[model samples]
Target: MQAVILAAGKCTRFWPLNEKHKSLFRIMGRPLISFCLENLKRAGLKEVIIVQGKKRDIENELKKEKISGLKIRYVIQEKPLGTGHALKTAYSYLKEKILVLNGDDYYGAQEFKKVLSFFPSILVKEEKDPTSFGVIVPQKNYVKEIAEKSKKPPSNLVNAGCYFIPKSILKEKIKKSSRREYEITDYLRKLAKKEKLAFFKAKEWSPLSYCWNLFDIKEILIKSLKREIKGIVESNCQIKGRVFVEQGTIIKSSSHIEGPVYIGKNCQIGPNCCIKPGSVIGDNCRVGQAVEIKNTILGANNKVSHLSYLGDSIVEEGANLGAGTIIANLRFDKEKIKTVVNGKIVETKRKKFGSVFGKGVQTGINVSIMPGVLIGREAVIGPHTLVKENIKEGTAFYSHFAGFKKEKKRI
Candidate 1:
């Protein structure tokens, strides 16, 4: 069976990190979609169609990767309609049975193979809070109904966005839901009523619905990595656990690294620094002296200056953190950190989520960013500034006279 991956969403909820498609977000020096494509290839699927946004960014990014023997065709979804509309845009290309998946989610090859074993099947996972997703009601081996984001969900088995369905379902016209957007679950609900829509429970599912979800994905990816070192580890440096250091990277003397950590190519780790576990440092990054990086994803070409502490954060490409900068990842009361997403205050359910730095972001010396703050792309934070809220794109934020006077200038 052929596969269709839905990647056309605007991802407004993933702001500050949504400069590109969510699938293009990298883990372990490769885009997340590349991993999904590789998994699909391993599942013995040769033909794949990707439904991407009008910008064609996902296609452009995926073209750089060499997933041999997988023939990928890109279909454009010009509008910001829901999943049903996105899938409908690729309907003309559907032939025979189709395996559908969400581009932003991580699924294993075994899960794909399991779903493909049954005809007209929907992959479901038992979730604690089913209200956030489309919960599936099962009748024997088939799906009875699908409730989309219902306050009173019938069951905890939620739709995992992987479906093995016949092409005849694509021919049926789908109506817009109450949200005024076409939903794929509506088609599933109709199918459950008329026919036996088979259901398969997935072994694992990692959906990147929010920015902090990256942490969970990172942890999952890092666990599968084996220890390999091609870089220079100087004497007096202490390395422990499963650490993968790429070529041309140097771990200087007096530095300590505890892994489940990945250091990419050409990175210069400090002579005196601490890299704690669950940290992935990308290529061409500079983690200088007296810096302590813990459980953070440092993108390529980033510079973490001396005396800085970045913990539980995601610093995107080309960001430079000035000296003595500290990112606070926890609150005084230790409650779950709440972040503003699309003007709504949403709890992160994580007590230690640091700020998210967008691409090319620059911070001055002694900058202090609070927990869960999102600094937009190319934004500048002046020295001695304490950032507590979200900063918009291209903004220049500064404070004077011990932060008594605050200013925001759009760059």
Candidate 2:
């Protein structure tokens, strides 16, 4: 069997990080889509057709991996349409029964095995809020109807977006929904009445529609990473638990590193630093003395050669952190961290979460940022700056405490 991975839609919700394709985002030094592809290869689905849009980042990434046993192809979605249109973009390539999966979601191996067991199956998961997913109304071992984000869903079982459908399903004429786009589930809904649509329950599902969810995804991927140490661990360093240090990475003496952490290749860690659990530092990252990095994901080539405290944050590629930089990761009343999304307050539901910095962002000394703040790509934060809100892309923020008046030198 083959799989058609959907990588088209514009991930606008995943801002800052959205500058790049979400599937291209790295977790534990690997792309998100690579995880899904690995499981598919193991499940005996060797051929894959990826439906993508605009950018060729996903296609470019696959070329570098050169993953064996997985034959890959790409089809352009051209315009931003619905999932149905995205699938249709690769209609010419669907010669056999295929498995369709969302490229951005992390569907583990267990879920893939279940989907392959049933023919014409749609994998569903039990969700707390079914508003985001297409709720499946089940009848015995098959689906009766699928309500796409209805006001009140029939059941809590929602569509996991992985489908196993025969080629005949593609023959159904695509109809546009109220949103003015074709929906794949609408076609599946039509088939449900005439035929019994097989169903499979997914054990794990992760929706990466929000940028804050990066922390949770990072934590999940890190727990499964094998503990390997190829870097230089100087004497007197307390390295506890499962830690993977890539080649050329150095853990300077006297640093305390708690486990389930990954230090990427050529990373320069400190002589006096505390790398807390769930911290993933990418390649060529430089961390100086007395820096404390807790539960965070630092992208490739980030520099923190300064006294700083980064807790529960996601820093994008090439970010430069200055001395005395502090990221506040909690609210005063201990409530959930809520951020401003399109001028509206959106609760993150995370007890401890920090700011998200985009690529090439730089900060001066003594910069303090509040929780849930998102700094966009190529942005700059000046010295003694206090950030309490989100900053857009290419913005430069500076602090001015005193008025510039050459009045008497105050001598």
Candidate 3:
């Protein structure tokens, strides 16, 4: 059997972090799509086809990984049409029964095997809010209908974006949806009406629909981690629980590391810092003295300077947090944190979500970022600045005794 992964969509909803393909987002130093590919390979599918956008960023990123024994092929979609268009673009390469999956989501190998056990099936999961997903209506053992984000959903079971279908399904013509793009759900709906589609309930589904979803995926990945200390831990440091320290990393004295934590290669930890559980520091990162990191993910080369407090936040690669930088993660009211996405306010569903910093974001000393704020790539925050809103890419934010100011970045 062959597998096709649809990865060509322009994930605009995942702003700030959407600088690259959404699947390229890393968890535990591995891309999310790489996990999907590994699961597919374990499910007995050796030949895989990836449908990527014209930029081919997904293909380029995967080339850095050392994946063996899988015959991987890439197909360019050329345009941002839709999932249906992406599937059609790869139709010439697909043969026999094909397992289709969404590249941005993560599924377990057992889930893939269960879906493959029932051919011509769509994997569905029970979700509390089906309005955001394609709700499935079942009849007996087959799928009765597939409704896409209907206000009054027929069932709570939603499409899990994994399908086992024949190659001939791609030949059927699908009209453009109201969103002006062809959707793959149209073909599934047609198959449901013909009573040829079956339904399989998925046991696990980790989707990256929003930025905060990264925390959820991180928690999921950390569960499988065991204690493997490959670095040098000073005598005074207190290491607890399951911690994975990579090569060339050093934990300085007096630092307290609570685990289920992952420290990537060649990193420098603190001499008097407290690294709480669920924290992941990427390669070449630095966590300086008196820093308290809790449930935060720091990407490659990030520098959390001395006396900084980063909790429940995600800092992308190459960001420099100056001394005394504080990221507030909770609201005074103790309610769910809300963030602006695509110019609209959306609930993060997390009560403790700190700011998300894009790549190369530089924060000056004594900078304080409010909860749910998203700083864009290459942005600069001047010293003593109290950021309360989202900062656009390449913008400079500063505050003085007179008032706050926003200007185009000079550096």
Candidate 4:
């Protein structure tokens, strides 16, 4: 069987951090996609086709890793069309059976094994919020019907976007969706009517759909981190729990790190610093003295100076957080943090969600950012200000919540 990995998504929900399709993001020196691909390789699958857009990051990474002998190839999805159109483009190359999956989600080996057994099946999982997705109505382990956004789903098995399509379906010449685009859901719905489609429940799965999803991945990585010191530790440091200190990183005396925490290569955790669980300091990062980071993800080359608290936030590459800065992850009233997406306040389902910043963002000293705020690429925040809303790309926003000045003279 062949595998068709659909990576053509624009990843709009992830916003600033995923402005580009960098699906192969590294987790502890290994690309995230690598983890998925290796699973397929170990399962003895040789042919894998990756559907991508104009961006060649995925293809380039495959070459950089010298991943050959698997008949790995790429198909260009010229337009930002639906997933159905993407699979149609790869029809000519598909043979007897094809495994369709999203590139951003991680499905365990056992799940793939089930797919290999049931060649024409859709992997689903029971979810509380099935209305947000195309849900499946199954009867006795077989899919009865699929209702897209059904107010009352017959079942809670939401489509995980992993399908085992037979070659016969490709010969049917399925038509495009109503929006003038082809979607995989339409094809599957048609197939479900014609033949009995098997369904398997997911044993382990994770979706990289939102900005906070990185926190889920971080927690997964921290659990796998080895509790050994590969790097040098200067005297006066206090390290506990399961911490993975990569070689060339330094923890100066007066620094305290509590794991499940991961420090990337060549990083510096200085004196009087405290890093808590789910904290990932990327390569060449510096956590200065008196800084505290908890449940945060700092991308490469970030510098968090002294007297800073980065909690439950995502700091992109080359970001510099000034001293005395604070990232408020929780609200004053303690409600679920909601982010404005496409003029809609979408609930993040997270009580503590800090800002999501793109690369090259800079903030002045004493800056304070509210929960669920998103700062665009290269945006700047002036010192002693509070950012309560989103900042546009490359724009500088500054506001002091001291007091509003009254207009004395009317012109």
TM-score of each: 0.96, 0.95, 0.96, 0.93
Off by over 4 Å in 3: 403-411
Please write out the lDDT profile of model 3 over residues 45-139, one tens digit for every residue. Answer: 89999999988998999999989879999999998888988898998888879899998888889889988998789898998878777788888
lDDT of 1: 0.90
lDDT of 4 at 134: 76
RMSD of each: 4.6, 1.9, 4.7, 3.9
Quote model 1's TM-score.
0.96
* Model 2: CA > 4 A from native: 404-411
Q: Count clashes in each candidate, considering only residues at least 3 apart in sequence or on different chains.
A: 0, 0, 0, 4
Model 3, residue 224: C-alpha shift (Å): 0.6
Q: Please write out the lDDT profile of model 4 over residues 1-411, one tens digit for every residue.
A: 588999987887877767667476665665667777877777667899999888877887777875645788799888978888887777788877888899988777777888778757999988887767778888887888888766777778888888888767755556766667778887887899898899999867677887778777667556657788889899888899988898899898888889888888998888889898888888999888899999888888889888999999988888888898899999999999999865678888899999888898999999999999988889989999988898888998887566778887877
Instruction: List, residue by residue over 1-411, the lDDT tens digit for candidate 2.
Output: 789999998898788888878888876677888988998988888899999887878998878875788889988998877998898889887976889998888888778889888777889989887876678888998999988787688999988899888767878886788888888897788778778799888876677878887776676677687888999989899998999999999999899999999999999999899999999998889998989999999999999856899999999888999998999999999988988766777778898989999899999999999999989999999999999999999999998798776677766
Write one digit per residue (lDDT tens) for candidate 1, span 370-399: 999999999999999999899999999997
Query: For residue 181, what is the lDDT in candidate 4?
Result: 71
lDDT of 1 at 217: 82
Q: Choose 2 or 3, whichever is better by lDDT.
A: 3
Question: Candidate 2: what lDDT?
Answer: 0.87
